[model samples]
Target: MTTYRFSTGETIKHVVLILGALVVLLPFYLMVSTSLKAPQEIETNRGGFLGQQEMMVDGDCVRQGNAEEDCRQRPVVYNYTQAFEKAPLLRYLLNGVIVTVSIFIIQVVVALPCAYALAKLRFRGRSLVFGAVIVCLLIPVHAIALPLYIGLAKAGLTNSYAALIIPWTISAFGIFLMRQFFMTVPDDLIDAARMDGMSEFAIVWRVMLPAAVPALLAFAIFSVVAHWNDYFWPRIVITSSQELFTPPLGLREFKGEMADHAYGPMMATATIIVTPLIVAFLLAQRRFIEGITLSGMK
Candidate 1:
């Protein structure tokens, strides 16, 4: 029989990790809980997780002179319903999908070729260029926000999908990550493709791309999550156009727009916005970990 025992340090480390996970998940828990609870319960902090699910009158329905019974709904139903009905939440979700997808596609298109060149092809100033990419990773988006906004504004691209996606199209981190992963790919593969008379571009698209799927998936998670949840950049550029607003910007609907803050609907909106990301990460968890581990193998 096999015996298993954890050392004191290992046990402590596990405990700390569990505590950290709880801390990170606490806000998400509250968001879902609050969305399920009646407003009174939320105010009183009375409902434990999942809430009592008591029936609540829809204030808007009542205000429209509907009968009280007709307006009544369980807290969960009311919150999630209002999340979609009260604002253009679906439109915002669509915008998020558009921006994230566009940015990721463009980033991959740019990054893959550059990464292949940097990884496989020996050329002058290659080290300097990669070093510059490394330097770019150190520079936060906030540092360049003003200049980027100004440039976009000068080009009359603000308040459009272009504004949301163009600035993010050239991702230094994407380039660096793909470059690292490509470095681990065997040189023999590229040589074999060349021996088959594949052009450089053909080699990148046909040869390198297939083997880089895991790494691409890893980068996709990063790119998609970052752009999907981005509020700051969207808020800056999409001031007047609610149609252009992303999921994060859609949350502003519940804040400062009404006399009583609609915490339930707001939380519901947040839950919807984050659900896709959570689902995607869960599905790709193994591949993501594999990509990260293998990317550094070279």
Candidate 2:
């Protein structure tokens, strides 16, 4: 039997990681605290994580304030309503869904076939083709943003979904990630499927896909987070379209509308925008970790 022990250096590394975690958590703590606080307290940035007392429960809430220390006893929804009414938040959410889902759908369509061919087939220049895909990963989006915008303009796709969808539909990151995942599939299983007369498409659709659930879920998490939080591209491509605003864009617009910035409402809007991504990441995190581990092994 063999025993292994971590070095003093390893212990130092662990302490550093813990310190890094606290650094990461402090901002999140402040944001959630700001969300739950009385409007005045948020403006002053004086609230704690759960905030000053008795303001919230699982059910019913009451408006707080107006007398000496009466504000702590009850809380208000006025800030939240002001935020929502001032902006078309529901439309923003819907546009986000439309753009992200559309991009994800297109990525799946393009990535699977490309991954399948690279992993399981031997065509002329197969290695070369795969290398090209890998090279695309090194090329940043900003490198080609100008050309894409110009191309979209030429095609009359500017200020429309086409401009958004066409530029990001098949992500280079998706291809590289999927190709790495596909390589990890057992060669014997693939060989057996071939011996049993399964076509390439059949094997991909049935056998390979069922086994790649972890990777798919992981990719979904990646795709959703990136597109949902995206602001710069939409800002560039979209013009004169309040209805087309996504959450991040909508939040900026909300900030502009207030004669005086309402810290509580801004924080509340931010909190609401963040919650879905957190829930999504939590649900997929287990599979995402496993999926990413598999890719690294490949």
Candidate 3:
């Protein structure tokens, strides 16, 4: 005995949101579709969604004098196999884990205390220091890239893990986000901690940190995604080190290395690279939404 309906504006908003989602997801669909398709299907753009998935012969296997029977495999299998076999995909994945984890850990260590101080402490020039952090948020990474690269080069730190990790140790946005979240926390909690003989450091770690878990999860996603997908800075600093190449840099293997570009395997590699982030976001989706909603409540 109940009827539900949307108003005209609400219906229009829903339609627009659905269209925007399709636009965002279309590239991912094509990447996954192409990864499953044969080269002929890809070139012709004939595959529907999952592709024909017909058996295809790998040219490299045949060129290496393998039997035709042995060389024939399904397009999906060929593409994924070539993705891992064509480069040190596992090594690149490990490097991504290392760099992203390192940067996140360092950023949390630095940002949490800075956020705590900015939010809780009343000291001289506190507003000025906080103003500086806000200013830093406005400065784009590209604006400071040359100076950071040159400083690293001068210090003989280029091509090392330090080069990757050091530049991102202090994240201004992380500090800002955590500070805003901390402002929403009750001042009584800090006073209680101080009554318990807890120093400022202890207050930050014990009092502020536990309450900031949602915000930290939100920051972690941002830090990990940015560093994991970063190719430009890594390309500049790790020019000579293949061992140090992140997942994004590893895609270069399929670009111009072979006589013919391996679009299927390249797409497969991209799919592989993006899978973890998607899984992570799904797992943290609730907390991420909660964090964003609660962060600006002050």
Candidate 4:
């Protein structure tokens, strides 16, 4: 009886979880579906899914020839061609890659050391500083945008990639994450490395870094995703040159210049913009999950 009850409980839990996952995934499914759909189908079909709710205009569609066109499906490839040829899509992608990689690399250099210091070294105002970082995590980027922009302008960094990349190199959240992961590292390990004639820096590089591989990788993914998907900062800083545009900005330009309200090309541009992030996640899925799951949790 107990075994049957356990099996029943497990089955119920899985069914609930699967439903929840589907619910969460529905929006993404729609985005991809609509992007692949013909422009006419998008206008006519109030809801794309077979059994989804939609507003019915009681024969309005049938009354006009456009009613059929509204339900007409577009060839997905044509939308993509229009999206790409209409804008500097390739330049946008290259610029995005450069800025995103720069942000993550610089973040690692700044974050890792500060994280190590907070984790291992004894110092004055340490707890206070840690508290400040935690507080900073609560603050949104928009709150600081104006001041940051002014400072960058004054420092002559405006209109440069430095404007986008430098200020973000030292992330307070990254420090918190690294510190939490480092705390889990045994103190004895550091001491042994010291006894073996390893300096503090050497110990950090040789001992702790190797030990913190998962956490580092986790942060790298987080850093890449955050910066790569971000469009606002790039929009603000990079204005003069089309060459500096990123994927998101490029897609926006495509929509603005060519579409004027054309949904097919807009959808195609969106699909192109998101493809890299999706591919990255797919390829590094295990590492990304493992890193986040274990880091700072214990």
Candidate 5:
């Protein structure tokens, strides 16, 4: 058989892609590897990729009046166990789920109707409203954080779940994406629903919402990921409330409370926090890509 050969351009492209993949994956590799390594191995940077897999004594456990024999564990076990035990990680995860889901649901509820109106309804100043949405997209959240926080403080919504969920309920990007996708739907569908005596509100829910699934899925991924990984806003709003801390904020608080050398647990916590988004992306990757692509076609 003849040897397979790639063109020079193909070879260069493959090389470039490989390099890019490596660059992106490097931090993930380090995070997992460091999480597996013992404190000594991490400090010395000596254990290689899988780490030594050696039994390590947990100094903190020993100091807590536990027997030395009980304190001895594999580095992986110690790191992960401490990550959960030292903090209310379960509560933090629950709070993350609650906040992320609540934000996504409210965003969809508020955005979908607005998007339908923008796409299908002919009303005065509709163009102005669409322009306002586009302009809001251009304004970074950080620019208005001070005013938002001040308002929340005045309203006494700070230090609660409302603080985390309320500010993010209205997603301009969500409205824009959904609106663009809705614009692509044939007008005949809406006319048919009207012919069947469906109210505009009924048509919005029954006809438009289902048709916009791809875009909604895409927006869901965006909304969930953004809120899930959001530390800055949560940290700002959720002051003095450990019970309401999201995963990122909990991880931050965990780091602050840990000793300087708790890299293993810290890395483990980060890995845990990051894993859900990775899993979600992997599972719905096809839908996610299709959604983004479809939304952009209009």
Candidate 6:
């Protein structure tokens, strides 16, 4: 039998990576486990990961004048059913998709041309524009929230889908990332396209855009995940419009409305809200990593 051993440094690195994985996955484990558990089990913290699956009487059903037999249910069923019944979760999910997709599409439209210009075009103040993009990257979204809100309010755009998406349409990080990736493209390609009598706009769209697919995919993942899980911004802009609530905002509102006894359902709501990004990341993980790696190489 062949035997192999890792070096001491490699062993330590492996240990650290394992620990980090556990730290990241811990919350997901807790959310799903809590969602599966009964209210009593969650409150007492008694059940193991899968819970006992014992049938329990729902006190809320009894309070609403249902018979004891009708109120009996397994914890998992109770939690998931309550999650759907207590809130318009499907609508919130749809809104999340709409807002995230809109933001990503608009961000690409705005960022790509700017990124291409910064990378390929030669003009005065080009460095200044690039420097401004870098500076914008350093500014957190929260810092400009008040000003953005005031402008939206002034325009009567508050509580609209435009309010959710318009502010994120210009992503400085997207521009910076794409610009770096674009810099790695050979000037030979641009010259060849020019030889074909293609305009600068045509080169940007027909040539550069296709080449930047991997980087664009990477940016799409970043933008979608950020906006999908964003609660604070939605809350700030979407007051008085329950219809405009995204998944995170809807989940927050659900938690606030529910009593302490409804912790399972709340966790279930969270699980529903968080599952899409996890699934999407798992599906595109290899591409996402490749994109990040290639973009950074320049």
RMSD of each: 3.1, 5.9, 3.1, 7.6, 2.6, 3.2
Which of the two candidates, 3 or 4, achieves a greater lDDT against the reference?
3
Per-model TM values vs. the true structure: 0.87, 0.76, 0.86, 0.73, 0.90, 0.85
Q: Candidate 5's residue-wise lDDT over 81-108, tens digit each?
A: 9889888888999999999999999999
Candidate 1, residues 143-206, lDDT tens digits: the string is 8888999999999999999998888988888899889889899999899999999999999999
Clashes of 5: 0
Q: At residue 275, what lDDT does model 2 achieve?
A: 81
Please identify which of the two predictions, 3 or 5, would achieve the higher lDDT against the true structure: 5
Candidate 3 per-residue lDDT, tens place, 231-265, comes to 88998888788888899888875565754548999
Worst 10 residues of 5 by lDDT: 289-298
- Tell how far residue 222 is off in model 3, in angstroms: 2.0
The candidate with the higher TM-score, 2 or 5, is: 5
Q: Would you give me the overall lDDT of model 3? A: 0.87
Error of model 6, residue 12, in angstroms: 8.2
lDDT of each: 0.87, 0.74, 0.87, 0.75, 0.89, 0.90
- Least accurate 10 contiguous residues by lDDT in model 1: 289-298
Measured with C-alpha atoms, the lDDT of residue 184 in candidate 3 is 99
Q: How close to the true structure is residue 100 of candidate 6, measured as C-alpha lDDT?
A: 93
User: Model 2 lDDT vs. the true structure?
Assistant: 0.74
Best by lDDT: 6
> Which residue pairs come into collision in candidate 2?
64-74
Per-residue CA lDDT of model 6 for 42-144, tens digit only, reads 9899899989989999887999999999999999999999998889898999999999999999898899899999999999999999999989988899999
